[model samples]
Target chain A: MMMFTKPHPAQTIRSSDAVFEVKDLGVAYGRDAASVQVVNDVSLSVGRGEALGVVGESGCGKSQTMLAALGLLPRGGRITSGQVLLEGRNLVDLSPREMRAVRGSGIALISQDALTSLNPAMTIGTQMAEPMIHYGGMSRSAARTRCIELLDLVGIPGAATRLASYPHELSGGMRQRALIAMAISANPKVLIADEPTTALDVTTQSQILRLIDSLRKELGMALILITHDLGVVAGVADRVAVLYAGRVVETAETETLFASPRHPYTKALLDTISQLEDEVSERLNPIPGLPPDPRNPVQGCPFNPRCDYVRDVCRAELPALADSVEGGRHPVRCHVDPFVGLSLTMASGGAR
Target chain B: MSAPAIQLKDVSVRFPIRKGILRRVAGEVHAVDSVSFDIAEGETVGLVGESGSGKSTTGRALIGLAPLAGGTVECFGRDLRALRQAHGALPRMSQIVFQDPYASLNPRMTIGETLKEVLEVHELAKGHDADQRVGRLLDDVGLRRDLAERYPHALSGGQRQRVAIARALAIEPKFIVLDEVVSALDVSIQGQIVNLLQDLQQDRGLTYLFITHDLSIVRHVSHSIVVMYGGQIMEKGPRKSIFSAPLHPYTSALLSAVPVPNPRIERMRPRIDVRSEPPDPSAPLPGCRFQKSCLFATEICRTSRPQLRSMTGRDPDHLAACHHMQEPHVREALSRAAQGAVS
Candidate 1:
């Protein structure tokens, strides 16, 4: 919290310094009549050992953007325009054979549900070992040894015996740990955890958060944590980017973002969290309307319909993602300055 | 206390396990064991616990969905079984809104049809009267009158939930068991549903048994909270007492583990390490169900189950099931936590 926001906006971070960078990313799904532009002009960068948190509701393109980077998007989905750079190499232009090499070695993804992600028939060891042997080119016996070590690294107790257990046989917590171990086996430079704790209990969730944080620190890997729960990101993220509809609404250092949010959506979002001070009868000051449908192209600002601070300019013209103030590095996209209303809401003892 | 809106005395719900082939009774799983509480009229009581903790079972048992092995349930001063069997307006007094709106609602039926069906089943209204009643229910839940014409598939997740609430309301239920009604929706939408519920409660003087695993939302809507672990009650009290000065070790751990939205506060609070697996039902623990992972467990905790009791004279309304509250060391732990908060 003591760390101040950077004085300059995110000024075209070079791929040499950033472990992963997505530039002017755009993704769309479906054919002719059913086509939907799910992601539009989205851009972000993750420096080595940095943690970038992407916060958004469903259908906000949080997952699609990362999936585009990994070439894991479902059928009918295409990266219409973008550059996914890893170590200054463009991933979008890579052949399937080349992209396969980049996946396990350069970048890894931990999806939301571990049960569906794991192979039900395969033992945890076999599933884990296959990845290491195929990617790391280790022998079967050596890969087995590495599997146990990876399981132990993830904080799973009795790692050796647990290796033989199937996914269903293990608890949800243990299954998630195994999944994380598999993701990190090749020691990828960038780790993307998409709603990693959503399926677990609070106690299990806490343990997973701690484990992921310590692993990032120990291994010096860049991390991208995608979640709807702002609290999860607040604990571990170095920087935060809030997405709305299909655009970046706010981006800033974690401390600055929490202290002085400039976007109305961001401010309303901060208050949506239930705190100890909330009265039983008092309603949480939620953002007014649902997120815009992706099937239809939004005009001007996508959030104008739901934003409390909307004005004529907000509905007529799109806001540029520029510095909120003259010298501040915190970038916000909104035609109207949302601070006046945010301060009023804050004075009522919300967003503590 | 003008006879609580609903009362449960020594309530226990169990399920018998059967063996393979012969289908003989093996043993029983005490889903909800010796749980007892009262929900006063027009008050919201939150029931929170992890999966398999019997929180959901407790809610189901109240509505007769889960059979009570041994206990007595009284609703509006009438026996629950008798009231359910009488089948007049008695069945309309209690209704449940489930978690998954997509699955709970009929896909083929329009929102209007769903609400109208409930009204017809209860004989609350008919023909034009039913149509007008359905329209009013939609308005009460904050949905547009036009939305009633749409199918369940056409509505958004939040809108579908509102229709489900409207269906529950069409029967004119005085008591509702909201079993994770808002957990599946987005954060912004969750607030909308919660507000609608609060508004409906205000208008109808409805009593609710809100069950979920999310502690923050529970604190937001519940006047009082009940914490369950395994099959027994860990803590039960007014919201402030349970959130601020929880006496039970399980309650403290559960609350402490929830990630706070603020980075400074969340990062600062010391965590209660509870990575151990939840208790096994097949081999029930001899004493406290939470003893395996409890930080203050001693020999007595492993020998005898601690009953829910008020720890201090400051507030008798708050109750916790823990043996260490009598010890000076427990107060020391509380002081240390306070010191941690200051820094």
Candidate 2:
């Protein structure tokens, strides 16, 4: 019986200090009658110099949660209910003009598709300098200098020479580095990277991960790394949050989460990699069934339909995240404890 | 070879690069540089490499999508060149599944019509029979029958890909070249589509030339793996042999860099550093193409070319192209840098 209550605030590793605190956040698109909730009752925090990996399948509300926090959800999307506290001030309470002021100055986002996210017609220098100009209120020459420094900081060689190059001219790895440099140019306290390395090859992916890891330490910046790659989370993230159907089903430290994942959905995701490694020819032990339509909402656990060990109570009442394994350090939202059948152990030293 | 489904013997695809107003041929970019491999019947051969490695070109050449400037492409004992001469083209044998599903499928046509087009082109079916077969093909690819009436825009990414797979099956082809088919899909959906492909391969006895940059999926699906670098085969062997005991430095680097889900292993594993940028195809290397970036390169390595050959004391299927592959020093270097981050 692992205790799964919210731990004392001090128990969390204050890598730098708390930078953002989100509580009972909900995001909806459009007005009341036309509203559609994309992210629901999600709560998360990013401590200074901490890398929190928010991982889930696509459309699992990881991106939407961060988007709500940043006030950047598309035209129709709005924060219906939530407390987004940045430096003890409520960001949701701010006016649009004030929120705009807080955006790049406080939080920056690196979108998944670098090609589309980046302005194609603009030179890398121009795009990189835009943040400094608007947020830092620097002159063109000063901003250009800062842009060159940023390009160099992110490991782009010959930054001065390459500043003239457009997004298309740079390679994928280079483009990502440039994007990271741009994101950090404003010296934002919180950085949200959505599938940052999904497009990169293995070799480049590791490089980018290392770069982000090192930069987080250097700048003492808090990070929310949203991705589908569990591999990326295992090595880098200090805290792990697993999302499914607009709800976070589990949260824990990286080591504890991997060693003893408590949620069935988490276990299934872990098993997927294990199966891949074991070279089993049979169909993957995937949680069968499509995600519930957001429009046609369901009651109780959203994953109940796909979970193998579903119970009657699980279908009728949503399980509150209770104490699980990891010495009562984390919480899990599942009917059965995940460790019952799993021979749970962290993979020992070798190629991962 | 027990009648290989497809074989490329010293095949090359070169495009003449023109410069200036006169458009004079300045040089030829050897996109596929005398690459050779074979896909046996009902066998899936995975071609893995970074961009510009010519994996896609090799796949395209097998299906006659790219013109071969040199060497031979023979399918089931029939020379494609001779067939082209006799029939003025090759058709309905090798179908390709491109990476981007949306770009591959016709936006205007419904899924039913897309499959119909494939059948009409190959003259496989017509009338009510054609309609019935189209629905069956969709079902074969794990897509719904109602999906046939929906346009590409209406379907999910995975559904559109199923439509592509359905169209590929419409020809009833023996060989299918899946070129990065699932790279664009979500990870969870990726597994579903990959499983579907594996099921289809087994049921139809299809031979696959699976081209992808994703080594993880390649390892799972391909029976044999070919690692390409700078348009040449760096290494090629049976999946187990190649994965567990890679001989080439390039292959060794590639396999180690693939991030496993387990954190401890990931942290402990050394990251192999391959070159950041792809090689310039137009510029011919003095010796081996990888020699410039390879840490093991010596004076001899830079002066002489290495042919793909088996390392002594290894299985004959395992082949690598490196002059120093059999040397103890080279092996030590490969193992030392094998798990390091991508170069």
Candidate 3:
């Protein structure tokens, strides 16, 4: 079930061919003593033309990890430590002035909620051109031409006329496309789309995903798709990273990760969502308890509270993201083997 | 045989499309167009659609929340609209649970106070007996009795949802409308809430009109499924048939659009791209409403609207509103199934 026949340490991939990489990244909110580090030592990379997905529940720090890399964290949110390297250039130490240069041209972000992400007062054309004029150093007329071309590229009909229309004038799908069009206006090397289609309809969702997939192919841009939906990640992502309480719990190629999850959290996440393919069971195997509060310091594994396969080791030592087998590159931070949880889950017959 | 717990017949919800400073009715907006379905006693009828497909409106109209322009809603052998008109208010036979647990619950009231208010308003329980019953309801939804003291903001999303369920259960309603109830929670928490609902349904023998955009949960919790598009019922059938074999093009497209969590299977599966924009509710196209997006749509489909007809030979409960029921796509799917069976 290996999608890419790949087994490289995420670091090796990051240090080597990665177009964008985040190493030992940490993010905190509030002051020093009272501050809570929500994102802790999270590392990830996306090879040029590769789609890497960061998936987790809310407050898992998946979004913060990416926002830190792009320097778009909310006010009061600070990058506590670590480096966000793009093509070997450290982005962490870059000043706000220098970071602004890299914001749209070096790396672009398509955030969730297109309605709010876009400026309500600006026309679609003006927003699309601002990125090009600022990052691409293009003249207003040239950027206007480029905007029209991008709108056409993103499959918006009557591209020239629609550019004059405001975001509110377009449908939900059209607004999302306009957002994507705006993000790629400067032709950045990396595109980070966070829950791009969560607000869209199922049919429209597939269209948006397909559009992103096609754009990645055509532009050869490194893609980081962040979402909580495993099904969405399974469709478009080359590799999958499962996050829990500000740390990576599992990282592997999509097919391998989905087929044989090593972490109990990953396995529970897989079993929790009811699939159309799966026969309707009497009850789903829900992992008990909520995600660990990021504000509270955790002892050992953060998932130990909810994990069915938790052992003494899970409670005593915080498992580092490490190779699971003698030669396996699939990294998993778990105290128990996959079978321990799988067999137990099966034996319990959907026991809570 | 017992009567169906909730039955909606030729239900159409329309709002006047107003314009200008005069606030005149220019045209009518068909929110729900002649949608019909029945929920058997202790049965679940999943009503699924995208945004603006009228699933929520249908659920609202069932409980007399959304004004129905036409058609009748009968709850346990009573005309719900007429009963509400005559009595000034219909008794709590049907209750609804909205998606946003935060907004649904009163922020000022504690969980205990909320449930107690429901009991008092409905005259189900009072005083010390009310507290005991509220505790039992809390237990039914898998929440601790002590949690009743906490306000909605103090509790987690899942806990607050369970309290909402307990509040609905407080009325002891025969029918419950779950409108995107689990859409706001996490995946793991969604599973927990679904299990609680299933357990509650079994224990209380309550009827459910489950409405949501998420099809997987619908398939999991529902005994029967109704696929709605463009404010119309495109397909309705037993869960087994609808999932295994779909007749309408829109139903098939909707099903295929959902990405499977299994990457290997998802990569190999065929996807039908519905390129057309979402159908406008204000101005629904003539003939087949899905014709704009349906790949198999032809001149015939564009010229004539199809009636919901039963599958004579297949499961008699299966019904699809499409002109080309005997199209080649079904045959091709069948042949593929045959090939699959042989291997």
Candidate 1, residues A102-221, lDDT tens digits: the string is: 997899999999999999999999999987787688999999899899999998989999989999998888899999999999999999999999888787888898899999999999
Ranked by TM-score from best down, the candidates are 1, 3, 2
Better of 1 and 2 by TM-score: 1
Off by over 4 Å in 1: A1-15, A31-34, A274-276, A324-328, A338-352, B84-90, B334-343
Listed in order, the DockQ scores are 0.61, 0.53, 0.49
Number of clashes recorded per candidate:
0, 12, 0
For model 1 chain B, give the 10-residue run with minimal summed lDDT.
Answer: B334-343
Give the winner by DockQ: 1
Q: What is the alpha-carbon lDDT for the whole of candidate 2?
A: 0.82
lDDT of 2 by residue, A1-352 (tens): 2456746465344412578878789988778777788788887888888899999987789999988888888888888887998876899888888998887769888887788889999999888887677767899999988888888899998999888999999989899999999888878899889999989877678788889888889998888999987878977899999998888889998877777776777877876665555452666655566677788776788888888777887889887766644454587777665543243333222122
Candidate 1 chain A, poorest ten consecutive residues by summed lDDT:
A6-15
Best by TM-score, which number?
1
